[model samples]
Target: MSTVKQLIPHDQALLVTGSLNAMEDDRGHDDRSLIHPVQIVLDGDVINCSCFDSLGELGVSALVVVQKDPLVTYITTGADLIELSIENDGSAQVRRIEIPALKDVHEMSLLDGVLWLANTGYDEAVAIDLDEKCVVKRIVLGKFRGKIRASLPSFTGNDIQAVDRYHCNQVFQDINGKLCALVHHTSGKQLLKRIARKVIKSQGDGGVVDLDTGQAVSLSLKGPHSVRCVNGDYWVCDSGSRMLNVYDATWRLKNRLPTHGWGRGADFSKHHGLYYVGISAERKRYRDRPDYNDRNLIEVFKTDDGELLGEIPIVDGIEQINNVYLLQRGVVETLLGLKLSSWV
Candidate 1:
């Protein structure tokens, strides 16, 4: 059996992509550079990447892993145009969820064993009942639910691996159960029209649809991207336009963080009272440069007053020299393959 690098992170399941580079000088196994290997069952399987953005030796050119559960891990190739799903037992499943009218399937959240997504179309998400192995429900989160079959088109590229350009949907649930979906707000719209848009997104403010009646309780506000639930309240990471909008369990706007940027992901490690936020500097510049970024570093801060701590560089180790490992017996026998190392 391959030596599965164990020291997994606190939110190991949420990790979408990662790598295993050789920090020291040891070139035993070193050629899989471009493939965005999302899931690594063993340590290293097969790296046939088309990694664009950067080149050379992968500081992290091993696997792109995203996990939500110990048993459930989703990993995709850098540019192979196909995502991979691997089980902890080293078992594998391949899929390209080709649903008509799909945009982008952003990071997912599992609540009560149900997967919730966000988007501008119907139901907002495609809920999969893992046990049942079927789509139990599709959240139609728009005013044009029954009528709008497909989500509005996006303004991005489909060059990334496994991304069909259709799975780009988003979803957010407030502590009070408010489900706010993102929308394309064109600039310079009439005042009444803007009001109408607000009313439509206010569907699930005081708690989502009635479990008994299937009715939506309209809230007065909308939630931005990236939200974390704490003590039944939501601390939203409004990354877009550089803002941190706060809301109550009822989806009411409470406050906003003056300090903000294009936040890709966030985690509050109460262990150290540290809030680690991942950001891409490119968001501010080259706004027109379309490829979804992978260059920004991580921002560290305190949870209490949101004081600035420091920045952890998320550099693509395509050129790292110490992360090393090998493929043996179905495991990424990384000295930290796939990204861990012997020192750990």
Candidate 2:
């Protein structure tokens, strides 16, 4: 007789996915080394999983769930983009969309049928027209901040076109539909220096930038990677600092939750009144740290009191995680080709 693991029944669940081994080198900038990207659906402590053979490799760095006919979900490899159309029976069909302007697509947001992607390779966030299937506009972080692109002659290319300048990796849209961006460094020179050393320090220089009004807001962050506006509050993954930074609608720093491992992705479950956070284990970058052996884990916390609830550890197969999303109860599974049952 086979043993079946039992877990607490939960209505809402979190879907955590990532680029396996993406963060092993180059501060996770080198996509070529990433592979075997996987997605795991967590219900309480039990889980169901699937891989990304049909979706393209080098690890899925960004994801967004769309509620529509057939229930669509979008994912990216920081370069290529794909979407899955899922049916009610938990089966899905994947489609790849090739856009020349899509370079190093990272954390993404969908608003009004338009997909806003963090084009980290180009140092800008690009707005892709879903209907037209083309890049409608590129919001250059430096230019959007009302600053000129750095023109240092020593560099092989212009600072604006340099890969990971500002390391602008996440895009967020406000309640009014205004676009905002999160970047690593505000100064091009400083960004270059950090790149040369291949180190992302707690510089407190990284923050949120208002792409429309050319405004910048610093929240004393360090290597901040993910940004989102949740329930009238701005939530950020201060990755380098290993903390979840929350800001009020007025942009004031509200609450900070110290996290385990490298904090990158987060999602709040409105129905469950809980917050799920992705905690990636320390890699070669933090080689000297003692927590290197720890596995990549997703932690749950009570939204009302910030109390620790439980943890879903990703053991075996997956190496690094980039994002976690809440799939409320009945959304279709985004991944296909798995033998696991939907209720597992």
Task: Write down the TM-score of every candidate.
Answer: 0.51, 0.79
TM-score of 1: 0.51
The Cα error of candidate 2 at residue 264, in Å, is 1.1
lDDT of every predicted structure (CA atoms):
0.37, 0.65
Q: Write model 1 residue lDDT over 179-284, tens digit each, in one string.
A: 5443222110101212322312111122233222234333221223345765455555554444455566675766665433455455555545655554544422
How large is the C-alpha RMSD of every model relative to the true structure? 12.7, 6.3
Error of 1 at 304 (Å): 2.1
What TM-score quantifies how close candidate 2 is to the native fold? 0.79
How well is each residue in 54-158 modelled by candidate 2, as lDDT tens digits? Answer: 343555777787665567877787887777667766666667777676676768888778898888887888888876767888877766533623232233333
What lDDT score goes with residue 344 in model 1?
9
